[model samples]
Target: MKNTLSPSFSRRSFIKTSALAGGGMLIGFNLFQACKPEAKPPVDISQLNFNDFNAFIKIADNGMVTIFSPNPEIGQGVKTSMPMIIAEELDVSWDNVHVVQGALDTKNFTRQVAGGSQSIRFGWESLRQTGATARQMLINAAAAKWGVDASSCKTENGTIINANGDKLSYGEVVKEAAALEVPENVTLKDPKDFNIIGTDASNVDIDKIITGKPLFGLDYKEEGMAYAVVLRPPAFGKKLESYDDAATKAISGVQDVVRFGDKVAVLAKDTWTAMKGKKALEATWTSDSKLENTEAHDKILTDLLNGKEFKTMRADGDVKKAFAAADQVIERTYESPFLPHNCMEPMNFFADVTEEKVRLVGPIQTPAGTARRVAELLEREAEDVSVEMTRMGGGFGRRLYGDFALEAAEISKLAKRPVKVVYSREDDMTAGIYRPSIKYRISASVKDGKITGYHLKEASINSNMYGLIPNFFPAGAIENYQVDVAAYDSKITTGAWRAPYTNFLSFAEQSFFDELAEILEVDRIKLRLDLLQKVKGTTDERIQYSPERLENVIKVAVEKSGWGNAKEGVYQGFSAYYCHNTHVAEVAEVELENDVPVVKKVTCIVDCGIVVNPLGAKNQIEGGVIDGVGHAMYGDLSFKDGEPQSKNFDKYRLIRINETPIVETHFIENGLSPTGLGEPTLPPAGAAVANAIKAAKGIRLYKQPFIKHMKAKAPLG
Candidate 1:
């Protein structure tokens, strides 16, 4: 692995030269060496067990080139963005380049799973270096033929040009470049000279999306593919007593019925037939299971929140003393229910099983993790199991949990035939993993109209949103703070959903700050600016934000939203959050309509280090904001007697076009290392909307399904 933190080249240089190459393509180069490279075994350009990969620029004898990617794109715009990165680095015309999905051969490709908004961020450095590295080799090969110094040569549009105007096409020089030992420490262009990196170019994959090409996992098809669906226990721990498969087999189109463990699966020739067969089974399940319903789970979490001495995720300073010294102390508790990802395409997988090996292909976030699990389940060598990732309908952390894929593999193993397990909308929603419900208790003190301290205790099912603690947030924001966390381990399973804990933390933290400003009689914007200033560069050993960067976004959002100014009857709320190396600030304009708070508009300023693709990044932020809004105010997954109450979109609400607010986005133009935008922007939105509602209604809400909390308190019709 190469050192990711080194600084070798700036992005500006690549942009300048890219423009001079005639603006036909945009390439992003990530200079990993941070310095000149030392001779080493040329990066293993071999196709092997890898998940994230950018294939070698394959130039045919006819001058056509193809750029292969192993990352599955699910509309977060990886298809458009990643190809741009590769084309930019290769100095190839975007028109002449064909981008395609790579095979799941780990020895040959990176697992093509896309989530965490990391599609572009991961490729930003390597793709550029790969292009630069290959271009230099080609230049050297062409220069050797002309008896000229390579320094006098420039590459343009897949051809090498010497000072004397002599040129050779890349296709003509590849043989020589291939024979030469890969060069060491090739120089990269300066950011000031860049033409492509900072420029706005159209996404390369837009055409495919518009035409509805087979670009996603749901679109994948194989010959002799049997459709199957698993009927698992209603809740997490409920087990099967017995099943009457006789009726299921009588259903038309039903092929075979197989029992693995706690559940049975019905296989058929198509999705509709398999689903019909499943309903016909009407299998009996034991009620003596330990799955807790929503109400019971809520009671357990609420009880835990009322207790003291929880496990601490972080603690600093004497929080007890700080709260004691204040003349007034404010405490608030907030809660959010579980949510489903509901990726548009639903969950499905195709697998071919044999006695010696298993080949599984579907939309998954972690290909290596899936392969490992499949290997274990099949009792086969890990090397014998292979996974090919398809463009997911949506990930949002749902794909991170491989239950759907596992179910497919288990069915394929038992049926002794290649099978594709497809989940109907209802099955996917009810059987899906969820974002854990959480309860947060926040306390802060104010002394004579000045802020003093803040303390938080959070109760949830897991420590991190995605089960991975990157320390990307807590370590960067807040000061003199204490964070205590306690989890309620239940049969209900959870996994990372987009921003994960950042979503809830931002809502809790930012909303509380807005309330704190109210208590201090300070402007919300100014209060955040002041708090940000205190921690910007203090060596106080408690600050984690880039004060200047955070402050810049705060200012931008304020200016765009016309903050510090007022309009009667129209309320505005502001919130900012930093995570995944990106800082986002948003201001929501809101009003109460029909006794329900409605969001009118939201203006956002996002700084994700350096944006690899402006259009794609914008789409991601917009989508994430809308997603957060729906989850905070509308989305709720509940249960009764341990059975999920909400089965599909009809019951589980989603934010539709009519509900989507007018969103205007601005980017913070700082030439910093690019961070992920996928899940970062989601955290601040719930809080921003919550704050807006407070301004609109003069009341604070501490629970999600925000409208319900509001309606319950208002007079009945």
Candidate 2:
């Protein structure tokens, strides 16, 4: 049977529904579905033994709140931040909350995909209502016990108090609350009365992480779990012709060598033995013409970018007329290279498969997709496969794909035993689902310091980004606007990385806007703000984002960073973009150290609406800036003859602590719904740094890895 996923519910609709399941006063919710159980009787609360909530919150007899963080924690701090929303509304202290990782229950949860920074944005209200409903139930129970009016009693800090000053701990009243009916309507807390949210609450896993606890996907273990490794094709467009596994089977500790289509797996007692057996396979592949090198790919991409009318994602007022009548027509092409997720923990998953059912455990961004894919590969019902999420060392869009988890399931089924498939750093890097290489052509027709028309063409692998407007910024801000997408197919596996298209696209678009400012003799920040001014109060139906929010962040970034005034020895660049429903404006300050650009500081202003976790939000912005800067300066992944040239960290680099700059983060709180913190913070950072480099070096670096274009003869500011 094909798996069907339910769509995410908006804030208002989510709170209007409730699923009261399990024994205690439990409120269950899922990103994809409401609380759904699989052929089990409703849990009884009379026993006082409590476990397993509906889909999210499980209230224990001791009043222990186990909030299931539905999204994967690829170090984005969702496991801690999400539960805060629930706890705050539950009238409970943060210290009283115990967070748990949620699993794949597509039948219940709406969707479990972790990428795109949808955790907070999607769960903002569902969780709050889950908590509020429970609080109401608890209050009702206490009111019934005292035979007082329900409104006469109130809850605070996990307790219920009556008007007569009689008090009861939530733990003492939870049993009675479990027996009461779930309230339909709950009064949410006023923003001014919030306790756990909008404050620095330490990550629930902080102590576990600091103490080096085994909580990550890499550390997942199960009884009698054998180790497995796969020998994938060395290059793209190649298929495994044959494999000699006899030598692999002869090795000590090697359990079996099983070939599965384009790949072969080596099963052993341990990881080291499995790796050795995999190496011994010596798999051969059929070599064909390959998609070779960045330069070659660039040529193909350029043709695709400019060669055709292609899919016009968006078109505003007469773009042709505006461009034809322009005083200055400017066009710039930007190339963003392929980037690896390079997660600290390489891809790995543990699968226990039998004739009737399969169970999986590991770190993955998308549990629902994993279960669905594994069920398909195993030729079983989706309900027969269960996937449990573990802590991820890093996702960055890498975990969003479920291929690694599927590979583990296949090996487990063939071996007929529980097995853990581990990918060595080299294997994970070479076995690619890398971020697609992209070429963007941004052009505008300006007349007297005003952009009369705009056009953007993007050529990339697989599908394009989410349409032209709403997902793409600066849309609606111009009258004559047009955006087109074209594609160039390749054998290379490509998937979302970090912010997906926005990660690379933002840098290119923002850099071009900076160039536009340069030619027009205007402030880069002011130019963007000016465009936003045109966006104000637009009645256009395509406008999904609030221009006021965008304008606010830009204004804050300028005011807070002191736009025109530069710090000593620093040249500043400004960029603002809105994506993932979050608005961000960034100012990057740079200095030339030994003729190389060194990012000295970055001041970012965000308008993600209400601030959920202040410090955590700051951390997300800081991490994103470092990640974007590191990529802009050095992140490059390319293929030569369909083979990945950079296989490990030694070859594919990441930002180090020594290279990290001071990041100042601020948020605009306009009392709107909370948006995502993870990805929106990342999209504009690269562009901010790229523009800063141009100001510092007196040259526009069109391509990524600005260092690659540096010349020794050029004078640095």
Candidate 3:
């Protein structure tokens, strides 16, 4: 693999650069060679130079510093967050730097993905060191010119200050700095001295977004870009059998009709023409491909869980003995249905392909995966394909799969011209690889106010939970805890959603824990605190997660929310979880009106190490909490005879502005490595809201969207 510079300034002073990378353009660029999908190894520290640092910063003679953000900007604001790390260490003012979204150049960039909230955490030190590396180079240049010791020189706000107070702008020293050798090890500023890391920084794209810029996938255009729409099978596991395009060809703008495997694409000069052509076309398929229904699917899962055999993922002590000796055993089943991402912008991509190389531009979460998939199809090396990332309206986790990107490449290759493949909102919703439907059968035994046994068995259709995270809570706390999983295969497409398995499971598990707290007649927070105390007290070094960290955040959340006391009528529920290496605790306030739960407010406390950008982090926390609450209250997707029932926004429900509640957020300052905020804040919200509903309505809810149960209950008096 190619050698990229690590921020570690050990005793050696060498940085590697590939062909097109220069000192001004390449610092902080992660140049990595291709490897297996599941493997990650550091770049060789030797064979290094400044020429190929992957070009994150470019200093013109005019001092216009353009920093290229490597990851995709899918509305999570990595375009601003990632660069802040670099600019902070480089000692440059935010006003002096201009950020550019970097295109997918695998040879020069690694980990350009935008999902899982990993951008900041992964690049935190590397980018900072890169900025530091540049600052040192500029200092070295100034010191040589002034004939002074480098230690006497200090850099600030893109200029070098010599002992005599003479200053040299970074632009004036760019050429000289480019020729200097990098230092072996430079000192990083302590967190207490940070000016940008903990301060408030808004999203840099706000102005462009508000004024309606062409940064989104749908707004992308090329000189000869034609619009193509794919007509997928009506149901899962079905394929196109025959088609009559006589009426389709009659459309004025329709150019050609072609088929790729199970999909047919109608090419037109514009999206409207292609859409119209698609409607006019006549197609037929097998009478029945894979018939799917909610009842049968749910039954299959339940049947699987009843069997004794299960892929036991985690097991502590002997659950049998603990349960057998228990004072009482309580069990409850909770469920959540499949939900679509429903991003503001539908799936779309633009690609230009030729035999030698392929160029792609669009919004995607995993550009490396997209490049790899496209390269695999074209039978070319990964470096031969370049994918450009654009700002997305939203990603959730749908963009993790490169199918939409692959579709664009295929269309571009076939048409032999630049083509933009677009999916209408209807197409996006109906032809979905949705979040897997989940079921939880939770049972616990209580013995004299101390838990004797805890059992959790989760069942799902199609996808087995890939995370299989060993670090889930209660792992190190309970002695006889057991976690099992069962999957019943189906034809429906199931993949990652925002928080994936944890999203629905948290609703079930957290609420179930709340129920157990009542059964044991213990305070909900106390029950969790008791478990956490067990973890912290344990001497085992192999504990899956940090018990000390979990306890700290939970304590802060309780203090900040005033959990036990509420203003007269408002009822509150609390939940906390750790994911993506970040811990979050949330409290939801609810009041019932006309038999419906109205979430009046939600307060969140997050501990993601040192807050990188407080304002941006809070925005993420607020958005994630609201999103989880909305899904728990009203979101659901189902199918009949293998065809989706909700086709568009007119039929599907989304959380509106009026539906948003007052969100108050607070962050814990630990000055540790910053973790991500994109996903961790979302996992606990569903359960917090569900538990609050149970308290207000005087009824326990085991079903998601809690709206499903409201219909059966009479209106509130």
Alpha-carbon RMSD to native, per candidate: 7.6, 6.5, 7.0
Q: What tens-digit string does per-residue lDDT give for candidate 3 at 1-717?
A: 212344443322333321112111111221121122323224222322222222576665555466777677777766667777778878887765666666766555566676677777777766777777777888888899889999999988888999899999887787888787667666777777778778887677665566575668898898777899989898775668999999999999998887888788899999999999999889988746459888877888788778775788878898889889888999988777889999999999988898888999888888888889998987778877988777788889998897888998988788887788999998899787799887778888877778888888878887567423544787788889888888878788889999775788777778988998898888999889889888876766656557788887789878888988888778898898888778888899998776578899988888888887788888888889989988888898888888888989887877888988888998888778888788887889988988888788777888887776665564544
lDDT of 3 at 203: 75
Candidate 3 global CA lDDT score: 0.78
For candidate 3, give the lDDT of residue 27.
13
List lDDT for all candidates, in order: 0.72, 0.77, 0.78
| 1-717: candidate 2 lDDT, tens digit per residue | 211223244433432342211111111222111112222223333344554334666676666666765556777777767778888888986655666565665444565666677677777766676777678778998899899998899888888999999998777777777666556557888888888888986565665566566788788887788888889988888888887888898999998887788999888889999998888787778988654667789888888975874888788899899999999899999887888888889999999999888999988877777787888888899889988778888888888887888888988888889989899999889887888888888889988768999999888866665223423568888889988898877788888888776888888888999988888988777788788888788778777777788888888998999987996778898888888788899999999887788888999998888888887788888888888888888888888888999998888877788988899988787888888778887878888888888888787878876666555336444
- Give model 2 RMSD, 1 decimal: 6.5
Global lDDT for candidate 2?
0.77
Over the stretch 94-205, how does candidate 1's per-residue lDDT look in tens digits?
Answer: 5556555555545434434555556556566666666776677789989999999998999888888999998898878877775665555565555554555666655554
For every model shown, what is its TM-score relative to the native structure? Answer: 0.89, 0.92, 0.92
After superposing all C-alphas onto the true structure, candidate 3 shows an RMSD in angstroms of 7.0
The candidate 2 region of ten consecutive residues with least summed lDDT is 19-28
TM-score leaderboard ranking = 3, 2, 1
Error of 1 at 69 (Å): 0.7
